[model samples]
Every structure is written in C-alpha cells, then in structure tokens.
Target chain A: MQTIGKLSAATGVKVPTIRYYEQVGLLPQPARTQGNQRLYDRRAVQRLSFIRHARDLGFPLDAVRELLGLADDPDRSCAAADAIARRQLHEVNARIQRLNALRDELERMLRHCACGTISECRVIEVLGSHAHCQGGHIEGADLAGD
Target chain B: MQTIGKLSAATGVKVPTIRYYEQVGLLPQPARTQGNQRLYDRRAVQRLSFIRHARDLGFPLDAVRELLGLADDPDRSCAAADAIARRQLHEVNARIQRLNALRDELERMLRHCACGTISECRVIEVLGSHAHCQGGHIEGADLAGD
Candidate 1:
C-alpha cells in the first residue's frame, strides 16, 4: 500500500486533485492506514495516471467520467469508447473552425491598423463599426464559438 | 421604440439572453412603458446588432465592453482595441493547437481499432493504457514512458 503522498509522486497528480477526484467519485475511496491516513495500491496509482492524461487531453470531467466507467467494465464493447472519442473529436473540429474564423478577422484588422496612434487606428474602426468591416472574419460568442 | 419581444425579434437574440445581456450590462436598460414593457429604439437595435456580430466573432463580454468604449470615442487610441483582438487571436490559436493534439490521438485510436472483440479492442487498449500511445501528442501531464 502507498500513502497519498506517494501516489501523488508516482502519478504526478496533485494531492488536492486526487482528493477532489475521490470527492467527485472519479476515484474510489482507498483503505486507511493505522495512522488514519489513506493508503493506495498500484492499481489506484494507474487509475490516477489515466485520469490525469485524459484531463490533459482536454476531455471534460463529464466525458472523463464516462470514459472511466467504460474502462472499468472489461466486458463492455469498445464501440462506446470510440463513440466518446468521436464526440470529442467533433467538438474539437467545431472549435477549430470557429478559431480559424477569429484568426482571419484579427489578422485582417491588425494589418489595417498599421500601428497608427490609438486615436486613428484601424483596430478601433473595426471594433467600433461592423459596417466598415467588408465582411471579414469577425464572428460568435468566444466560449460558445469554441 | 419597440417592446422586449420586438427587440428580441430584431436582434435574433433570445428574450432570456437579451435579458441576460441587459443584466450583465452588455445592453443598457431601456425606458419602460406605462404597462411596464421595456422599449428600445433604432440605436438600441443597431447596438444589439453590433454586439451580436462581435459575439459571433468570439469576443468575450469584457473585451466587447472595451470595444464598445473605443467605438464610442473615435479619438481614443485604437491600440487597445488592436491589443484585445490580438489577445483573442492568441487564445484562439492556442486552442487550435490543443485541439489538433486531441484530434491526432482520437484519429489514431479509431484507425488502429480492428473491430476486435471487446477484450482485444485497440480503442479500449489506447484509452485504457496511455502507454500504448507512442510519442507526438502527449498528455499535458507528462506520464510518457511510465
């Protein structure tokens, strides 16, 4: 059995995050030592490592929860896992499209600015009046766009 | 002047969302009619349109506020407006990079899956053990060969 601190060291996940995972039920509660401290095993560490990787991949907590559930059931079809990954891919692609639009608009506006003094800058004109925008990349709510 | 419904119709923004914008101060409060109905004018309509378009471009409310300020004062330095746009651009590009990483992983996992029985599915194998992932798009958590 490994202490919480050791689990943290092995998995490179923060102790608080591990605790939060347990609180949220992402991780199962571990056994307690004689000193009343939590004791984890190698499997727990492996699971923690998996959770950390999925989060780093930008999988939302809800999606990660689903993935974890699927992982725990060895007899389950992998199609479900594929489906989740596909959903994530769809989201990522949609975000890419929106960001690409934003990129184009920003570049066009910046190019027009020519770094003129703030008073007469093109950036202000673009932001101030959409009528002047000749239909360039200006777009949707940032968060929703993603 | 128009009623809230009319304003919603004109801007194509949902009534609750309009109210939310108003509550958040994105849209200024309009004069109320004797019957307590909110009334808006042509300028309000125009402002709403601008707000919608800026939002479409993924500008945050805070940045939109600054943009509105710049738009109102033509003489203000356009640099700030440009800076905000650039900042948004940077953010969008960063997201694109992350999304690409996710895309690569998902695509590879899906490809490697041979529709094998659940016990031997490549998809499950990839997700169950990040160790199966060769290099390239690594999790931000750095559990590379461990």
Candidate 2:
C-alpha cells in the first residue's frame, strides 16, 4: 500500500485529478488507512497510468471511460475498442481538414498583403469580409455560451 | 440603431455570447435606450460581423482582440495584423501535425488487431506498452488541473 502522493508520483496524475476521476467514476474509490488517508495499490497505479496515457493522446474522458471498460473485460471482443479508436481517428481527421482549410486561407491572405496601412490590409480585409473567405464552415463556429 | 436582439440576428452570434464579448472587452458596450434597452448602430453590426468571421476561422479571443484593434486603427501598418494571422496559422499547423501523428498511430493499432479477446487485443496492448507505440511524445501530456 502507498499514499496518494506516492500514487501520484508513480502515475504522474495529480492528486486532485485522481480524486476527480473517482468522483467522475473513472477511478474507483480507494481504500483508506487508519488515519483516513487514501491508499492505493499496484492496480491503482496501472489503471491511473492507462487513464493518463489515453488522455495524453487527446481521447475525450467519455471515450477513455469506454476504453477502460473494454480493458477491464478481457474476455470481451476487441470490437468496441476498435470502434472507439476509429471514432477518435475520425474526429482528428475532421479537425485536420478544417485546420488545413484555415491554413490555406491565412496563407492566401498573408500573401496578398502589400504591407500597407490596416485600411488596405489583406489580413484584416479577409477577416472583415466573409465573401473573401472560401465559405467553408468550421465545425464549432459558435463560441456562444448557453 | 438596432436592438441587441437584432444585432444578434444579423451577426449569427448568440445573445449570451455577444454579452460575453462585451464583458471581456472584445465588444464595446452599446448605448442603452431611454427604457434601458441596449442599442447598436450600423458600425456595431459591422464590427460584430468582423469578430464573428475571425472567430469562425478559429482565432483565439486574444488574437481576435488584436485583430479588432488593428481594424479600428486604419492608419496603423498591417504588420501587426499579419503577425497575428501568421501566429494563428502556425498554431493550426502544429495541431494538424499532432493530429496526423495520432491518426497514424491509431491506424497502425487498428491494423495489428486480429479481432481476438482483450488478452490478445492489440489496442489494449499498444496502449499498455508505450514501447508498442511510435515513441512520439504527446504535447500537454499532463491533464492535471493547475
């Protein structure tokens, strides 16, 4: 058995994040020592490492949960895991496509700039006039809060 | 002069978001009517549209603020606006590169799967052993709360 700090040191996951994972159902509630301190085991270390690795790869928390579920069930087919990974891949691909479009637009705008005043600036002009853009819709165009 | 609702309708920026932009100093506080209703003019409409278009291209709020300031200063050289756009382009490019690497790893992981149980699952195996991965470090590997 090790203290929560030891577990954090081992897994590189912060103490608050470990607690949050437990609250969010990602990590199971740990055992408590006589002093009421959280204690973790080797299994906890491994599990937290897995979660950390998945998150590092930019998998959303829900997807990481799904992957964890699959990991816990060794007898289950790998189909679900594949599906989750494929879905993440698709999302990444879509983001790449959108960013590429944005890059091209920015490049064109920059290339057209004659280094004049802001009134004649191609960069500002492109941003101000939607007609000058390629009309490609971004995935999350609305930054509005509910 | 137009009401806030009319401005929101014209710009496709949600009402709450417009208010947030005002709160963040991204948008100027419009004059209120005798009854205390917020009123915007044609210049506000144009300014909001410029903001909306810049945001749609995935420029961060600070970058949007800079772009707006440049737009407001017609006599200033376009160098600053060009720099901001270039920086955004660099960020977008970096994201694209990271996503591509992720895509390749996911594809490789999927390709090696033999559709076996989790004990033999390539996906889980790849995730469990970073040695099985491409050895590329992911940026922002820590998901810890500050």
Who wins the lDDT comparison? 2
Give lDDT tens digits, candidate 1, residues B1-146: 89989988877787898889899998899999998889999988877876776676677788888887777776666677888888877876776676677778878877888765567677666766668776546556321110
Root-mean-square deviation of every model:
4.3, 3.2
For model 1 the local lDDT of residue A35 reads 86
Model 2 interface CAPRI class:
medium
For model 1, report DockQ. Answer: 0.37
**Which sections of candidate 1 miss by over 4 Å?**
A34-36, A114-121, A127-146, B141-146
Where does candidate 2 chain A have its weakest 10-residue lDDT segment? A137-146
- TM-score per model (chain B): 0.89, 0.89
Can you give the lDDT of residue B1 in candidate 1? 84
Taking the candidates in order, what DockQ does each have? 0.37, 0.53
Among all candidates shown, the one with the greatest DockQ: 2
Tens-digit lDDT track for model 1 on A1-146? 99999999888788998999999999999999888999999899878877877776667788889988877787878788778778877876766665676778778878878765667777665654676665645343334522
